[model samples]
Target: MPHRTIELHVDRDSVAMGDDVVSHAGVLSAPRGTLLSAALELASPEIRSPGWSWVAVVDGATTAVWSVDHGVQLLVADRKLTRGPVDVFFRYFVQIDPAWLFDRLAHGVRADRRALEEEYAPIAREKYRAELRRRERELDGRFLSTECVDTLQHFGAEITLHADVACDFTHDGDAWSVRRADTMFQVFRGGGGPIASIRPHALGEAWLVGMLGASARTAAGRADLPDAEPLPGLELTASGGRWMSRGATVVQVRSELAARVAQLAYGRSVADLRALLDA
Candidate 1:
């Protein structure tokens, strides 16, 4: 459904070049390059059936995902495209300008977009690919300009986290071995002692809550993104709630998710991470 131009045949056994999606809506090939794919999905109600099977032959590498007849509908992978409110097509997935290829196929080609691309050079009987790659400078310039952006300086730091936490745990049912938190070494003005300990697990849990709050906030602002579950911690104006943590790690994780959301919402110009639940 993502690609309207490329014809999708419901035949799985057939091998064809440029047949983007094969039978059962499986991806067959990429648009002439290494198998740097954005995402892939192969599903079936009869997936476990002995006959239910398929393969992807991207750049001559044979690969199969689902061969079991089990009812399942899932997002098969999580690349940048999965985090997006953006299309999973060539624009973000394949990193290609969606309209540039047909720029020259405008001189009255009596067919659909696919026909314009396929018959572009061959049907006219010329060298291979006569109308591809015309505007290299313009395309590359824009892409490059967007890439080297420290654009949202404050946002960048919050999206990624660097943490150092250590604790001790024992195998369950051991009964003899006990779980333990790392020693919180203290050197007071008067003396020094190990006053208490820190639970690495609690720290991690709080950090994750903060991360989700940030991810949810940005995801909410974008019109293209689907509605996500509510984050109670996200509601607190300042400082974390009972679950969320108030620290650099939480901020960093939120920033990472926000930045990705920004990228996905690029064309629409949604310039924020904090807003209404239905922004």
Candidate 2:
């Protein structure tokens, strides 16, 4: 199967001030039988908005308007339109919550007051009152903050295409380079995934040797390390190059071999490298 790139073009870049509703016009080019999905990321600490509505305009007329809980939905088609391009125009709006707006104003007022007090103590009392009034006036109108605008730009409408083609995946030859090994261990130590849960010391010498070979040792000594707690339904041998549970093997090691061993020991235990060497 051949790999193809899909492109999405949006007409507008920024939302208009005082208007929660934004207009978007775009075209999607993809192969036939590809699935398309759209999503919007509007969650931010500074802005709060209610659900949105999407309208698909066809032939200069309103074809459909959908009330979606969030701005994520699959584009369903009766037949695949892969042979050509598809034009899409839509509008969406979010209702800003009043309470959230008020909270933001209150926090801003407090922060301004503190800054004024530190700089001008004598006039701070009067300035704080005036600042509060100014904030209220600012809140009376609809507006988007700089932060909000930047957030919108980042989390705007995103369309993704899923192709029904097999990918010829190949590992990068440098995946197990020192840098990658460092990153993998960092993520493991930080408790980023399930593999991080296994105690490194419990891993069999066979696995450690594959990862670190004779250059590494557990606190219990290199030859007589304790057996790791068995993974459910996984019968691991005391000696093997690949992890019996997941078939993972240590592909490369460098100056950081000992450190990687220590990380794997505490992060997750696995089978020994001796299996691969013996084979």
Candidate 3:
């Protein structure tokens, strides 16, 4: 069946501070051809600016646009959208008395948490817990460097930080021989570390440091990283795949799933047919 896709352009400045996924103006409908442009031209003059932009694709053709006052603040209303289409449009005035934005962001963050937990909780409990524990131990003892924290704080856009899991490990001079539930992760110390690591169960992580060049620019644009640097160790892995080692203290990441995560983290797909040169 064909249906419409509705999306909104949101900016932090538009909503009262400390809100999640709230914006001053938004649009709905399909994203096709010049539908966005035409809709913008028909938008109210007060809500028009270049600070934020988004596209929605509906069915196979129809499209729409939403523009808003770049300077005004809009409270994020905590209203869950319906199933099929994100059918809701709100516009807030300049001066308001109540804390509407605060309520909205709180509700939105809670909703997001519920959605994510529903989806990932089972995976962690059934197939991912042991491996995930191993990875976290690696993250804390050996991999948790000032640089790693800086990188994650700057680029690692983790929406929710799960409860910390503990494990045992021994620092082996150069690397840490950490022991997880049923696995061992040899976390490297000093300068060079694992940019991305995956397990046999399609779980992985990647670190982008002083690499990633233009790809870094794209990642930063998506708020995944803080700065644009060289894209190093584009780690790729998959579930039920044999572990592929790169010789120097491989972190045992699967291949397929790693590629997908890299795309989200790097803002580009594996089949980047854009005549790319370096990371």
Candidate 4:
């Protein structure tokens, strides 16, 4: 039950371009901060504990490491990595249909674009119009003839962009701060000495999803479907070890680390680390 880290190591002679990287899924639970701390603690070949269970997909050419943890996967290109623990937890997940199916739609390109077209299209359009009008009002009738064109141009530049962030996790801390520095949201009591920092997966909050699947019985008992009550706090009180989420989005923190320990058992590397670490 060890965390499975699907690693993709690049070869020295491998080409830099093209599909030089591969991906696989594994499981691990080392809050973002702890991961960073461990990475910093290591020298080139210090046989340290694998930090947290990791399924790493490494680009052999660039040595970029992409790790999956808590269902969130991250891409560490350019040899740079997350210096701090991510303080966000997933709010929820909604998997929409893939875009390729729309290409085969009989209705034409419009139909093809309709899958995630509604994702943020309406909001974008409205925001565009509002910005145009605001710009026009600011002109104070000085450019009446060119108002429409100016407004449109202004709108184009001012429009906001959004990504399909299904797992909406939040942290009280500043996003910019965490993204740029080495910071931990929680203290590490793992007894392995001071941790380096925690690192979260870049993917959506798959950690929680896996947890929900693992503890379906307890979660189901907590509520009914369609109206299932959200966990009020980030502190999950189930298995044993207490966990604090990066924010409210991580509504359910593990009450125990027993299940997490079991997950790492499935990974050969993690199993080896666990035995050697004697945790």
TM-scores of all models? 0.14, 0.21, 0.22, 0.16
lDDT of 4 by residue, 1-279 (tens): 533322211112111245236421222334333443233222111112222212222322111121121222333322233332222211111122222222222223222224444654565556655655565446443211133222222222121211121111111221111111132221112233321122232111122222222333244453211222223322323433444335423222333432242232222232232222221
Error of 2 at 216 (Å): 88
lDDT of each prediction vs. the true structure? 0.26, 0.30, 0.33, 0.26
Judged by lDDT relative to the true structure, which candidate is superior, 1 or 2? 2
lDDT of 2 by residue, 1-279 (tens): 633634434232233475446444455445455443331221111122343334333233333333433333323333333333344444332222223222333344321323433444445446544654465455543222233222222322111111111001111111111101222321111112222212222332222333333322332255423334322333333223322223342222222343344333433323223322222
Tell me the alpha-carbon RMSD of every candidate: 24.9, 23.4, 20.6, 27.0
| Residue range 184-220, candidate 1, lDDT tens digits | 2111111232212112333322222222334444555
lDDT of 3 by residue, 1-279 (tens): 533443533221344355445544455443333233443333333434443322222222213223342222222322222233332233332222113322333344332324434544455444444655556545644433344334433433231222133222222222222122233332223335442443311122231221222234454464323333334654433446633444332445334433433343343322231113123
> For residue 28, what is the lDDT in candidate 2?
46
lDDT at residue 153 of model 4 (Cα atoms): 24
Scanning candidate 3 in windows of ten residues, the lowest lDDT window is 201-210
Candidate with better lDDT, 1 vs 3:
3
Model 2 worst lDDT window (10 residues): 161-170
Please list the residue runs of candidate 1 whose C-alpha ends up more than 4 Å from where it truly belongs after superposition. Answer: 1-11, 14-39, 42-51, 68-279
Alpha carbon lDDT of residue 247, candidate 1? Answer: 32
**Best candidate, lDDT:** 3
